[model samples]
Target: MQLTQSSSVEIPMNDAKEVDSVTLEPVDSQSGMDGGLKAWLTVVGGWIAGFCTFGAANSFGVYQALYTLEGTSSASNISWIGSLQLCLIFAMGILTGKLFDAGYFHHMQIAGMLLYVFSHFLLSP
Candidate 1:
């Protein structure tokens, strides 16, 4: 009853006491996670991604300063922009983090990238 990447299954016939085992192959073969090429690439990529995300998160002060200089909005009202950005990031992280844990990483990654590009185009003047 145990299933693995290359495990087999046993089927018993109604009229016979013999059992037949059917070998199964995994749909996709994964690169080793034990310090393999994929693992190193993932580590590097994650570092870069973390750098970008945190870098943007930390730049909110610059944005708030600029907004305050503009005099078009109060400092408190301008603060909401940064607050909303962080809120969306953490909220989406919760949903996307679960998707990653559930092994829908590629699906989520594609959807996220598409959404990012689409939003850029949408919000651009």
Candidate 2:
């Protein structure tokens, strides 16, 4: 109630019907997620990537044993190498996921394959 030296009741008017009339239009932003050939291929690619990275980490026992036999590096140093490799693998997965989200999966995968091959070449000493 608002009064200026005079008794008067002012009822607040609501334009709810006008507001309700303003409907929202939905946008088609998200792509369809049908489990077709492409979707299955993506799943297989993910599986291969996961195995190559995490599976490599899991095989560190064999690596450590071989390295120990060869006397290539100390136990502590060899352990550090495995840990560093695993850390880099996981850390870079985030970067790769971002690149994939930005539609650069093929480019990134090619780069990764080249890097892997180059690393193997370096290890051929």
Candidate 3:
């Protein structure tokens, strides 16, 4: 009996086609208003406004002491006023976060600053 074995041969290519180079277009500078100096300024302004207005709550201790000494209102009643102010300040974060995500942070920030200034000006009397 005779057995034959066959070997497979591999073929090699001598020349290959070169692919064309790709060209990319430059990005426009003013694509959207979401990011830039204005946006950063808005964020900074919002933080300042929030701290100036809501942060006043921390002075409750001074007001409480004065109110107690004046004897016009009970300490318990004044405490509730401070608590309510604190609750509102914290709750406003929810709305501010949503508005900021919606790209309306600048508008909201400006409005908030105006309101803060106006409230103080009008309430000063």
Candidate 4:
């Protein structure tokens, strides 16, 4: 005669296996409209400013050639002018970034705008 024993174990259902109704947050209809307007305004403003400042700088090659002609200025000396300008522009970016990180964007932007206007006026000669 032989005796045999059987063991029974209960398995629990996985939490993910249970199907429950999901509720989604409602979307705001005006959200897209508001964001689009703001984005477009920023893009337009940037384009205007870029064209006025950077676009003007791109025309520097024409001016440099004229300045480097005989009786005006030596090419070697005139080349330094552009180098100094680029150096100053890049250096100012460092300071501006620091100021912006400190939440001084408005002041920095105002100062930059004023400086840009003043420089252009002074160089208008």
List residue ranges in candidate 3 displaced over 4 A.
Answer: 1-54, 121-125
Candidate 3 clashing pairs, residues 3+ apart or interchain? none
Cα lDDT tens digits, model 1, 1-125, are 77776766655556654645444555545653376787889999889867866676678788678768978789999788778877888888888888899999889878867875675485332
Residue 110 displacement (Å), model 2 = 0.2
Best by TM-score: 2
Q: Higher-lDDT candidate among 1 and 3? A: 1
Per-residue CA lDDT of model 2 for 69-96, tens digit only, reads 8998888888887798888987887887
Any idea how many clashes model 2 has?
A: 0
Task: Order the candidates by TM-score, highest first.
Answer: 2, 4, 1, 3
Q: How accurate is candidate 1 locally (lDDT)?
A: 0.74
Q: Local error of candidate 3 at 32, Å? A: 24
- Candidate 3, residue 110: how far the Cα is off, in Å: 2.4
- TM of each candidate vs. truth: 0.59, 0.64, 0.52, 0.61
Tens digit of lDDT per residue, candidate 3, span 37-76? 9899979976986678757878777878887898988999
RMSD per model, one decimal? 8.2, 12.7, 16.0, 14.2
Model 2, 35: alpha-carbon shift in Å? 2.5
124, model 2: CA deviation in Å?
A: 4.3
